[model samples]
Target: MAKKKALTNVELCKGCRLCVGACPVGAIEALMQVNKKGYEIIRVDEDKCIGCGNCYTMCPDYVFSIEEV
Candidate 1:
C-alpha cells in the first residue's frame, strides 16, 4: 500500500493547534518560522504521519490536505 501524507497551507492556517492535538501519531509540529500573516505554521513529519485524517478533521481553517503517496 502507498504511504499516506499530509500537506499544509501555512498562509491559510489559523494556528489553532487543533490538528496538533488531534493527531494520533504525533506527526505534526509547530515550525519556528511564521508566514506572511504572522501566524505560526505547522508541518507534518512524513516519517511519523499515518495520514489518519485526524489533523484534517480537526483543523477549523482547512489548512491540511491529505493524500496517498
Candidate 2:
C-alpha cells in the first residue's frame, strides 16, 4: 500500500494556527515567515505526520492537502 502525507499551501493560509493545534502527532508548526497576504504560515513535518486529516478538517482556510507518497 502507498504511504500518505500531508501537504500545505502557504499562500492560502490565514495565520489562524488552527491546524497547528489540530495536528494529533504534533507534526504541524507555525513559522516566523509570512505569506504574500501577510498571514503567518504553517509547515508540516512529513516525518512526524500521520496523515490523520485532522489539520485538513480544522483549517477554515482550506490550506491542507493529503496525498499518497
Candidate 3:
C-alpha cells in the first residue's frame, strides 16, 4: 500500500472543530498557539493518520491537504 499523509495549513484554518469531529482515526489535535490568522490551528499526528481525507472534506476553511507518499 502506498504511504499517505495529511498536511494542515494553519494560516487558512479558522479554529473550526469540524475536521476534528470528522476524523475517523482521531489523528488531529488543537494546539496551544494561534496562527497568524488569529485562530487556534490543528496539528495532524501523521503516525496515527490514515490519510482518509475526512479533515479535507469537512473543513470549511480548506485547511487540510492529503496525498500519497
Task: Compare the candidates by TM-score and give the number of the best one.
Answer: 2
Report the Cα lDDT for residue 32, model 1: 80
Q: Please, what are the lDDT tens digits per residue for candidate 3 over residues 12-59? A: 988978988888989999888899978988899999999988899899
Count of clashing pairs, candidate 3: 0
Of candidate 3, the 10-residue stretch with the lowest lDDT total is 29-38
In terms of lDDT, model 1 sits at 0.87
lDDT for model 2: 0.92
Candidate 2: regions farther than 4 A off: none
lDDT (C-alpha, whole model) for all candidates: 0.87, 0.92, 0.89
RMSD, every candidate, angstroms: 1.1, 0.7, 0.9
Candidate 1, TM-score vs. the true structure? Answer: 0.90
Worst 10 residues of 1 by lDDT: 7-16
Which segments of candidate 3 are over 4 A away from where they belong?
none
| Residue range 12-40, candidate 1, lDDT tens digits | 97677888889998999888878889998
lDDT of 2 by residue, 1-69 (tens): 888889989999999998888888999999999999998899999999989899989989989989998
